[model samples]
Structures are given as structure tokens and as C-alpha cells.
Target: MQKALVSIAVAASLGLGATAAQAAILDDVKAKGYVQCGVTGGVAGFSAPDSSNVWTGIEVDYCRALAAAIFNDADAVRFTSLTSQERFTALSAGEVDVLSRTTTWTMSRDTQLGISFVGTMFYDGQGFMVREEDGIESALDLSGAAICIESGTTTELNAADYFATNGMEFNTVVFVDQDEVVKAYEDGRCDVYTTDSSALASERSKFADPDAHIILPEIISKEPLGPSVRSGDTQWFNIARWTYFALLEAEELGVSSANVDEQLGSDNPAIKRLLGVEGEFGAPLGLDNAWAYQIIKLVGNYAETYERNVGPDTPIGLERGLNALWSDGGIQYAPPIR
Candidate 1:
């Protein structure tokens, strides 16, 4: 099943005029007329197709913000749904410009995958989900229980290490990808399902009875998820990295889509610099002076994106938690744009 996704991703890249592996990704993207983004096949609240088949989620918005920065059109981008196994290979092979899916930033992936993580978009942790009737109040109660997990992800290793460290024995019903894993869990093939706490919330929303499952409170691992790009393209990397920072900077500076126009006329130097009214911050990244401005005006700030996609008001219902700004007692912080 996942093998077919490889050909699809490669064909999409080739159709977009993939030329000269060493060629700068930005140049190639410009030539192609749109940014090619790789995303998970379907992960609600992260990157999943809506009823009309249009992709929607926080990660999708990140790509939209990037497109706004580069082309001044937030819709100037396309997506390819990828399985976890093919995401890295697809990126390394030039099959996609950026992997904006829910990929965790880990040591081995950072140094060994020939890819660079832009920044932590969402700080999450490993957790378990079970039927509310199971009466399992904690992950510690899952000893010897069969857990459904997706293969080719940090989830498996994290589940293994967590169980072993806790002196608990377990069995994993591994599947090739997330959709299959969810299906097996729903089919009653596994007694428990485990993954990032955010994902647990997202996936559970799709269940027949959303209130039938409960996510355990024991967070087992630190999962800093973010977008990533192929290594060796400094200019492209800078563009991708700064796009994330722009969202955070906008949130911190009180700039949003609704007020970006008004703030543009304000005299605050940081606001001016962020909106391209008083600084050339976009020049170094080969983007226009209004790059961040376009992002804020089109995609809104980080808080806006989070709230609209997966906040307490959305069906996924995730709190700001560690995704809140550093000034608000969270770890999210961006380097000043000077």
C-alpha cells in the first residue's frame, strides 16, 4: 500500500519539473509555479483532506504561509499525501519541497537523514488511548496489552522504550501506516492505541463515538514535531526556517491578519521590521520585503493558525499547552527578525 505512494510522490515531483538534484529547490519551485508540499495521508488537526478534498490543518497552513511569503498568494501550493515510511525518502529524493506533516524532530533524524528540521511547531508527548470502558486510567495499566502502532515512526520505538523502562511487558500490532493502524484499532484487533497525545486527540475525534475513548495522562516521550526540508540548500532552508519564526514573531508582536494593516502604520520598530515596513529582513532569504507581512495578512499569526485548526474550540480541542508563546510560560520562541 505504501509502496504505491512512493511512485505517486515521485511522479508528482517529476511532473513539477524536477531537474538537476543539485539545483536550488527555490529556483526549481519558482520554475514550477507552486510549492510542492508533502503531508501525512490523513491526520486530522494536523494535515488531512476536508470534505471537498482540500487539505486543512495547522501544518497545511504553514505551507500556505510559506507560499504567501514567496508568491504573495497563500493558495499557491499543492500537496501530496505521504505515509510515514516514505516521507523521508520522498524528501531526500527531491520528491517534495518540504515535509510539513507531523514529523518529530529527533537526534538520529536530524543528523542522519540528510534533512534539517526548521523548528518545533508543536511540542507533544507520547500517550495511549483506550476504550472508556476499559477502566485503564493510566498507561501503566497497559502491561501485556496489545497496542496498535504505525511502523516506520518514532512511535514504535518510544512505545517500546517506555514500556521497558516502566518494567511493563507489551505487544505491538504494527501496521505499515497510520490509517491502517487506526483501522485495526477500530476493528478491535488491538486493545490499545498509542501515539502523540495530540494525535490521540485528533484520531479519536473520528471514532464512531468520540466520547468512547480516553487518553491516558502519562506522557511517555518528548515529541517536538516540525517541518523539515532536504539538506544542503542554505537559501531554501533559511526560507523554510524563517517562515515558522515569522508566525511566532507575529503572535508575539500582537500582529494578526485583522490588524496587520493597522499595525503596519504603527511606529513600533519590531512591528515595522516584522511587517517589512522598516527592515530588509526578507532580502537575505530571497523573498520580498513584505514576506512576513503577506504571511500575517493571509495566514494570520501562530495563535490564529493554532486556534482555527486545533484549539479548544475546534473538534480536536487542543489547548495551547507547550505550544504557547515563551512569554506566556511556554517554550515557543523565535529569534528576532533584524
Candidate 2:
């Protein structure tokens, strides 16, 4: 009798452990039938709506990739536009499953905010933008200029630190929304606009005369912008992290939405593992074996998404300098899927 009781207790404990290990995010999102993705109100090339109200950009692609991996449908995502101040709070309150806005991954944000930054989707730098006629070729030239910046964002702190470090004085015109900041800049209420270089490119393209503005050559600080999830959910964090890495690995392996099925049978060992040809990688993440295949098939790889949204050919016209693949002398590299 004693032996049977001990055996029963052990089996119950093991079952409980197994149940606890299941992904809460996966279950919640599956039950709801859609993922709530937080995005900026309107930051072109990162997250913006088209004429038909379809949200499309690098960040939007990340959210869709998550939905595709879980639900097998990229459209199983609902985008929630958030401001800088409301982003963290909204994410913390369970209002959004993931925050994929142009948020900087800093130490304070990672530690103090009770959120986990999954991985960098875009390698960016802080910079200044001014009217072409202002002759401000560098950030140093904006010593006493009035700068337009978004409040409650890393841009404000970065701007302060950059100016202070260089012993320059400047005035800041703060706004809560990107649209207001852009409008103020357009109205000449601010002599310059300071933000991430990618955002500068994005905002400039929205101007009536995009040719009238020029982003300065100075890049002040590194900004690794990516997805974020509420802390305490390790399963959710892993899903977001591995999803991003899968996108990068797909790009490295030349797997796009167009050719994902073909590449699933590739000779490369890493590609084989990533596409779930002969590995148990996705099992550990609480996903199916073809999880990566779903992501790449539905959302394409990092390069494809970047080119379509913000690359040199797009309105943003950003060159893939540091954002290129590692083999191409860029910093974008992913770990082996195996």
C-alpha cells in the first residue's frame, strides 16, 4: 500500500510539472484566435497602415510571424497603435500580447520595466534631421537649435545625453505623438528633429516635400529595436526570441516566403534543422516541428521584409549597411536552429 501511494504521488507531480511547462501565451492566443500586437501610431517603415487600413512594416511582420507560427494564418493578428507613454503600461496590463513598436532595448527597459526584449529586428542609431536649406551637415551643428522629439521615449534621453556629452546647448519641443512632432517640424516650430535614424528616414518620407529635409550624417547612439513581452512568462519570451532568430536564419539560408517549401528539403544541415526536416528544435519551444516553415512561408525572412518596407528601393530608402547578413559584412547573424 505504501509503495503504491508513493508511486501515485510521483506520477501526479510529474504530470503537474508537464502541465506547468506548457506555453501560456500559446494557449491564450489560440483561445482568443488572434494576437494583440502593439505598434506606434504611425512610424513609417516600422508600423503604418495603408490606404486599405492594412498594417505593414518590419514590426508588423514580426507580429504576423508569431500569429502564423501559432495559428497558421498571418492575418490572425490585431494591431493596437500605442504612444510612447502608453506602450509599456498597455503591455503590462495584458492589453497587448507583444509590443513591436520602435522601442529601444536598453538596460533600464529590460530590467526595471518588467518586460523582456526578444531580439533586435533593426540595428539603428540616433540622429538628427534638419531642413536641407539649414546647412546643418552634422548633429554638432545643432548646438542651439530647437529640436522636435517625442516625449517619454529614449529619443529624449538620448538627445539630452548626446548634447550634454558634446557640451552643446539646445532647446527641445516635446510632443506625445509622432504626428504632432512631424507637424511641428513642418511648421518650422522646431529647427531640427531628433530620433532614431530609421525613424528620421521614415518621418521624412511622410513630408509633403521629402526632398526638403536631410538627415544629418551624425549617428549618436546605438538603438536595437525589437519586440517585447511582459516579464514572468518565459514561454512567451522564448517564442518571441526564437521567432526573431528564425527570421534571421531564414534570411541567412536564403529561405523566403516564395521558396520556403523548396528550401525545406535543402542539403544544408542548419537549414534542414530550421525547417524541421530532422530536428526536435520546435518541440522545446512548445511548437510544431514545422514552426519555422510556417513563419518563413507566411512572413518571409528579415531581408525580404526589410527591403519591402525600408530598404533603398522603398520610400524610406535606408541602405542595409549594418543590417545586412553577417556573411555580407553586416552584424545580422543568428544561432544554429539545431
The model with the greatest lDDT is: 1
Candidate 1 per-residue lDDT over residues 199-260, each given as its tens digit: 99999988989898999889988999999999877789889999999999999999999999
lDDT string for model 2 (155-223, tens) is 999889988999999689999988899889999999998899999999888788989999888888899
Clashing pairs in 1: none
Separate clash counts for every candidate: 0, 0
Deviation from native of the Cα of residue 24 in model 1, angstroms: 0.9
Q: Number of clashing pairs, model 1?
A: 0
Give the residue spans of candidate 2 off by over 4 A.
1-22
The residue-level lDDT of candidate 2 at 107 comes to: 94
Clashing pairs in 2: none
What TM-score does candidate 1 get on C-alpha atoms? 0.93
lDDT of 1 at 50: 84
